[model samples]
Target chain A: MMHINDIDTPSVLIDLDRVEANLKRAQDYADMHDLPLRPHVKTHKLPEMAQKQVALGAIGITCQKIGEATAMADGGLTDIFLPYNIIGTSKLDRLVDLHARVTLSVTADSTDTVAGYAARFGAAKPLNVLVECDTGAGRCGVQSPEETVELAQQINDAPGLTFGGLMTYPPRGNIAQADAWLHKAKAALESAGLPPKVISSGGTPDMYRAAEGTATTEYRPGTYIYSDRMQVAFGVGTLDDCALTVKATVVSRPNVNRAVIDSGSKALAADAVPAPYTGYGHLVEYPNAVIIALSEEHAVVDLSACVDKPLIGDTVRVIPNHACVVTNLFDMVYLVRGDTVEREAKITSRGNMR
Target chain B: MMHINDIDTPSVLIDLDRVEANLKRAQDYADMHDLPLRPHVKTHKLPEMAQKQVALGAIGITCQKIGEATAMADGGLTDIFLPYNIIGTSKLDRLVDLHARVTLSVTADSTDTVAGYAARFGAAKPLNVLVECDTGAGRCGVQSPEETVELAQQINDAPGLTFGGLMTYPPRGNIAQADAWLHKAKAALESAGLPPKVISSGGTPDMYRAAEGTATTEYRPGTYIYSDRMQVAFGVGTLDDCALTVKATVVSRPNVNRAVIDSGSKALAADAVPAPYTGYGHLVEYPNAVIIALSEEHAVVDLSACVDKPLIGDTVRVIPNHACVVTNLFDMVYLVRGDTVEREAKITSRGNMR
Candidate 1:
């Protein structure tokens, strides 16, 4: 068995213990809420982890693209939900293949996306289409309940598609607001004679505050598997609950004020945490050390305010601002328990940017 | 033969014509300045691209990690420079293997890093160690000219290391300040009976302002090979000069003002350009469309400003904020000219964070 430090610098280390606890906590929360959990595979991008999530009672898995769903299917995942408007002939072709492999569902905010699915798929092997609602998030979703009902009607009318339900990428920390929007859309769809089967919702902090018997029958939380500094800032989890940590070596300690780590945007990723929380990551070793900036391969850290500073050649572990993006940046990650390295997990679905 | 449009959506599309022009322009500029252009391969991560840079009269290629250099060496690159203070034995072991494969030189800012090299390599094959200076960049390097001389002395005194010269990742748009600092360091090194042979300096914006008879012997520019929005904002190039572009399909047009593309933080990356220029990237086809926000796989575009808003299923190309990080996010990219697809180039050196 190898030690955690033995792994290469700038390598992603996942605490198996913390990951298990996080997984259990999320599942337990879902169970208490009486909702089926469909963990998004985009977080880990590992088929093994997705399988583990399913083994712990996840109804299925959520994928963003056909490529990721295909990987998860190949890894023995039977059901997958892609929560994005699947467009183009290339992706639709892959979707057809993935649909044949597993029980697949997709989301659509426009009739253009619904038409693509209807064009290829037939009534014999129908695809479930969820209507994505804005829900005040202002992202890729229909603006009003009327648009949601119209899109759902279009899906219901299509021979190859079924109106699965309503889903929303909501504004952070507002469960009631999302529920209200989805509730209006659900009522609208009900009046249109296309009663939804599953109302999907997610986001870590909001998921915790979700009330029972809401329109949402299921929740899809991706980042909770590896809670990050951003999640901590969002009032979801603490720093100790964060499972993923980037192990970087201090390549340069230029002065008493600053140090540079090998892990920069390329390794740790450049996704900044939602406000109030400054810096790219939380230096676990040096709690007060500020990761002021990041170049492609250099993480410039301000070490002056810290009681202890890292020296050149010293190893430091950093909890990144965002864990999902960080996972995508690495080809493989170490699953560790404290100082012990368990095994290397390949991010098989990484860069599945279809 | 496949059309460029026939390629998958959210794919990294490289305009070969634009790439060739970008390459030639940078090469001509370096030639005019009489500086041996050592193009950093961190931008493209393709060994083929690195070979092209070498063929276009680059002295060599600059890589951040040993993994990247090893990949380049495997692709027939003979000379390599790693502008990083490489620490830890895991990396040092790889360095020894890479040293045997190519002419290798590395940078050091501390004695700890120099000692690691000195312990590994012998006098017969001494490693040329460059003393990295701050020069107000304030990321990684010795703070003053005196510290640079002291580190140079340490490398020179070491049995298996030769004081190669000096290098600095300087502040943007300040070539003179960097040269002046290097001038003082060069003077100090000369007084200490250790005259430097090479004084390397780089930064796209500052590189253009670099004058002849300066202390900088050579310049390392990575993004110039594929000028990004950040480089454009830095006044290095315009949007038309950019070689790399992300082709994404309009999956959702929620309202008259709101549109969503399949490409998001995952595809375009989250590296924000230095001030004034806003949003994730420049929308090429719809120049006025603002990519307001990005989730993992959803680029939220605000299209209110545009007169000709893209309809659903329409494909749009985006020139990302930072091309290097964007390149790292994908495994393969489509090389195209006009509407004709050339071939798929594998980003083989991608995720080489080690």
Candidate 2:
């Protein structure tokens, strides 16, 4: 049993108890609202955690890339969904390989993407394709409900392609608007002689409310398992609920009110704290101290507001503003129950952007 | 004999010719000015590149951590410098191991860090310690010239430490002020019966002006070997001079003015382009296109300004805002000369934060 203190500085430390609690809460919420939780593996790319989520009543796992889906399937996960408009011939070939490994589904917002998928899986088990709707996120998605229906029709018409359903990663805390758009899209699809089998909605900030209406049949929350500072700022959870933190050692105390940590932009990530929140992260031990800025290997902290300043060589845990990006930064993360190390989990799907 | 176009999308492509040119230019500038170049490995993190720099008349390589120094040493690099105030027993032990393998020197801005180094190597080869002076960078360094001299004296008095000299990463384009501060510090150290052996000043933006006066004896530049968008914005180089680029395919063209690429913050990095740089990165093919924002796996590019808009599946090479952080994001980088793939270089010291 390795101790938590024995682990190296600037390592991602995940609390197993907190993770389990978070997992249970989300699953229970989904169960109460009659929604199947298809937890996104993008947050914690470790397939073991995905397996645990599936064991804890999650319907399946959700990946954002073909590589991630393959990693999950290798971990023995039977069902996986990639909710993105995947394009390109090489990627579609890899997607076909991934689909053969598990019950896979992918999202597409355009006919070109559907055509690529159709070309690759022409003779295989029918590839499930979901139409991605915008729903006010203003990212990569179809513009209107009618546009989604047309894309669904394209998927339905394509060889070896099944129109799976609809999915959207809506803006955080705008669940009502997403619900409205999803409702309209569903009605439009129904009128066009196609009803969505699965209406997947995702966003960690609005996860608890995902199953509140008829629009979302399943939820695909990524950051809910290891709630971070961003989630806390969004009122989704409190500081106590944040399970993942980067363990950093104070390498230098340049002045009375300034301390530099080993964790910089590489470990803590460069994701700006989405507003209303200030600073790069929240220090667990010293709540008043702020991570003012980060260079590549140094995190400059402001300690003027803190009642107790950290001395050089002091270890501090920091909840990153965004946890998903932080997971992608490290090769391995240690899982701990309290202060006892459970095991180290490899970030299997890390840097698998292709 | 693979072509550049044959490589996968979102892969790091290193132009060998541009890299060699960038290296030669920096080395020639340093040689003409009589400044020893101690190129920082934090940018490339490859021992092969560090060895190449040493071959090109670099005095040594500068690393940000003990692991990087050890990795460089393993690749047969004999001399290394870590410009960081290292603390903690584990890290100091690693530092001792690193020093045994190479002619190593480290920087300290605090008495605590100096004491830790002294206690660890009391009976071994005397550890070289450079007192880091804050020449208006406002990062991890001693506040004033007096403070730097005091720290140098402390290092000189320590049992197993040699007062190497003064080092600072000054603010870019403010070399005159840094020169004045470094000069005063050197004079103060001389008055205290401790003449500085080496005065090191670093920053790629000021690499050309490193040895204009007697303030610096050596220079440690990280990004000159792979000039990035930020360096270009600082007037260090142009797009043609950049050696590293992320090759990405346009995955989606949501609208006539909006395009999404396979590379995002994960590949290109999320380091905000410091002012006068209004976007995330510089696209080589479509220079006018602005990489306005990035998600984890998607770079949302605004193509409204580009006359030659890239269609879906078209590959574009992007020069990230900061190359150092981007280098750490990938496992392997493909090295190429013109259109032919030379080989792939493993980022040996990547994620060596500890």
For each candidate, what is the lDDT?
A: 0.88, 0.88
TM-score of chain A of each: 0.97, 0.97
DockQ of every predicted complex: 0.86, 0.74
Candidate 2, B197-227: lDDT as tens digits: 9999999987887776468999999999999
| lDDT digits (tens) for residues A38-105 of candidate 2 | 99998999888998899999999899888888888888999999987777767877887787778989
**Per-residue lDDT for A1-354 in model 1, tens only?**
999867878889999899899999889888887889999989899888998899999999999888888888889999999998888877888889888888989998888888888899999999999988888888888889999888888888899888899888778767778888888888887898888899988877666776542888998889999999999998887999999999988888888888888888998888888888899999998998989999888899998789878778788999999999999999999999999999998988899877
User: What would the C-alpha RMSD of candidate 2 be, to one decimal place?
Assistant: 1.5
Q: Count the backbone clashes (under 3 Å) in each candidate.
A: 0, 0
Q: Fnat of each prediction?
A: 0.94, 0.72
Candidate 1 stretches greater than 4 Å from native: none
Per-residue lDDT of model 1, residues B86-139, tens digit only = 888878888888888789899988878888998999898888899999998888
